[model samples]
Target: IYTGVYADGVNQANRRKSRHEQSFVAPEWGWAWPMNRRILYNRASADPEGRPWSERKAYVWWDADAQQWTGEDVPDFEKTKPPSYRAPAGADGVEAIEGIDPFIMQGDGKGALYAPQGLVDGPMPTHYEPVESPFRNQLYGQQANPTRVEYRRDDNPMNPAPPEEHVDVFPFVFTTSRLTEHHTAGGMSRYLEHLAELQPEMFVEVSPALAAERGLEHMGWCHVVTARSVVEGRVLVTERLRPLKVEGRTVHQVWMPYHWGSGGLVKGDSANDLFGITLDPNVLIQESKVGTCDVQPGRRPTGAAMRQYVEEYTSRAGVTDAEYPPIVTVSDDIVTASEDTGTQEEEDDE
Candidate 1:
């Protein structure tokens, strides 16, 4: 019912066209979702009376002569439904929707600045610090999102955050992304000669200031250390990775492409190894895109030494085996409680 192209013949016809000068929507070129409607809520392109807001920008509008909605693309609304048509009192389902209502999914069929439901965090958007960061949240008393998901396991150790001591141990910020030359995890692209040639080895990009501070030389080998694992990459001292001034402190950021891995022909340390598995509470997506780590010049230790190297940093940073950082950190009471618990544990050990 959504895409009207039903058979192989219809699908072929939709895909045959190369270009159309008349309309950019190209309804005939290829099918779109929701009964082949190209633009969702295209009804909003016109005024309440179903007239185009501007002739040049004309999209879907009501055809008074045909007494139905007509447009370059399929009408999102019931085709026969006129603009003036209003639902009577106590109407149910689609019948309850008014003629002026463009957002059919919403209860009131209107855009909402604040959602009434269907959100785990809250209605309005609020800024919360990342699960791991070098700085404390400056705006609110809360350091990070209280509703964020945390995997409190031995393997997925978390770096220290604000209100916790030794956050400076992992002082630099690192983020991971993709490079166009290689596909995700380099599964297909890495084996191919051409693609592998484009990005021969994994590399980390750092700002000039960070390079100077860390004594990193361009094209030299360096390793990024986190509580989880250490991954080394060839140093690329570039201005693309900028140093930002936050809270009157110059903060440096490191960036790497998460394409290369051990299995790939163009093998290098995987940037993903540097991240811990923290997730958004709502969607459960791993928040591994950004985190904090320490950058050191040279390759990371291998085998048993790698484990010890990571543990050394965690120990120095005071990262405990206690449950992931307390969810609600806005109150001093919670911090005090956590400290008290830590003190009691130390006493018990004594």
Candidate 2:
């Protein structure tokens, strides 16, 4: 911004000066930073005919007779360019750009509901069921995101997500998020006394119903397990993390902060470890926010016991001999709330 506006050559003589200090700078940042734009896409606040869309929201526009783009703010478009101007056929470089188009970076020189390029998945937005869900997609037969990439390795073994028999064993939905007191992973903040004092321990947030069902006490120890790993955290029984009714079944969700690690000044467990490797096609982003896990009321095992404990879960969950949920279409009979209640809901009585 400094280079674009207050560069070496743009002194008072070279640029037009503001009449008053009030007009020159914002009160929040009292220091006058020359040519600082308060808004982006200021051109959109006006109409293509060079008029404000409305008097209440006037921004940049063109004055055709003067043949200049003028407004309260400096023009993003070429100053001298008029609205009627059009780029010639096969014009390369800047000449290829259009006057009315505010977002020139786009291939169509306009906003797109569908991407023309750079989307690894597809051009248009399509709804895919979450990688882990208690319910199935009703609109289509496909139970989960078919495009989602799951990794299979000795170190990063994934859980049976959906359309699989064993998925029913690890019943609760879990999501990892941040707390107000610390930043993500808490690499630096956890070591500090002030911030760590505010949120002292790594804990899991659960609803009253979930706590009652699992026999978890407020501030008591609990183990959160996934196919990859097991993590122990203090259970925090809170009304904030409520259970939702999905497909006629009361589905419970647990919340945990990802700020903890196996090693720290305020050590507990790395909540991130409780996840398998699943990547988004385009960005290769893991669906880190939500997954499935069974919350047990007790501390997690260590070393060899930990491996045996995980095997016990997998063995109970019917993960025998490298079994995984295949990409498949689900029948409505197996996935309605009434039939899916605690299991699969067949039909709605209502």
Candidate 3:
């Protein structure tokens, strides 16, 4: 599919002339997939009769004189196909698709408001709280995504969520993201002295208000504690990490870069250590982006003390064993088996 679409010896001129706003599509510069068509389903930019929807926003349209589709970008439909062409009776495959249908790949050649297939959850979009969120789901009685996968193990203990007691043990929201200076987990970039010097050590970003509330000093050592593990980092008190008011309650968030590890040239505790194993049911992607953690002002304990420290918090939160949070919560009541069983109770018609 990428035959003539890549920048190479023969296609050097097109790649060199690539510029922004150059004829909008810049078909001559660079390349795109599926026969170098810059836009997908560009036929939608025109009307059923193949006239441009608007002159200012014209993209791909039919050339009436030549009786073929032509414009700034290549037409997504068959090149010689005409606007008035209709699929004959008993037609199948490409021949079955109407000329006016921009989304030819779909069964009915139309965009779906609610997907009928290709999803593990329901067909329609629905909101669910994060697996380890501090607050309850305000919009729905169902607290979190019931379809989410959980690993109920002694090592991967979950933090207490809404309707669970001792949620305050790990009150603050903790999140991890990539830093521009280093590549993912700093495997290659940390080995390079230049890149390592750019972001030498791992640091957590917090708002000034949170620092004051937690007795944390700017640029001082601080540790984030989760039921899973404890990770320490230098503190960076900045206004960029603001506290949000969710449900009229102040919610402080701690942000960290997950590019540091023990093997790297610039070593530090991994920010990912603070997350438990909760996954999206469809793709099975680990939900490590956000969770709950408690922030402390000093470096975390070492060796056996570290294990004891985590145990103390978990014991208080009532999740020290293999028992995980309930999968389904309706009106702050468990309506499903514990996360280990992954079983949900059928709803009762009230």
Q: Which candidate is the best by lDDT?
A: 3
lDDT of each: 0.84, 0.74, 0.85
Candidate 1 weakest ten by summed lDDT: 7-16
Taking all chains together, the TM-score of candidate 3 against the true structure is: 0.79
Arranged by lDDT with the best first, the candidates are 3, 1, 2
The per-residue C-alpha lDDT of model 3 at residue 317 equals 88
Determine the backbone clash count of candidate 1.
Answer: 1
Q: Cα lDDT of model 3 overall?
A: 0.85
The residue ranges of model 2 lying beyond 4 angstroms of the native Cα positions read 1-45, 50-85, 91-97, 328-350
lDDT of 1 by residue, 156-192 (tens): 8888888777889999899988999998889889999
Top candidate on TM-score is: 3
Q: Write the per-residue lDDT of candidate 3 for residues 1-350, one digit (tens) a residue.
A: 65655445566335646466478677667566647777788899999999999999999898989989998887888888998888899988888778888898876566676987877776888888898999988887888888888887878888888978899999899888998989998888889999899899989899999999999999999999999899999999999988999988998999999999988679999998888888898889987579999999999999999999999988888986858888867842343334324433323322
Lowest-sum lDDT 10-residue window in model 3: 341-350
After superposition on all C-alphas, the RMSD of every candidate to the true structure, in Å, is: 7.9, 9.3, 5.6
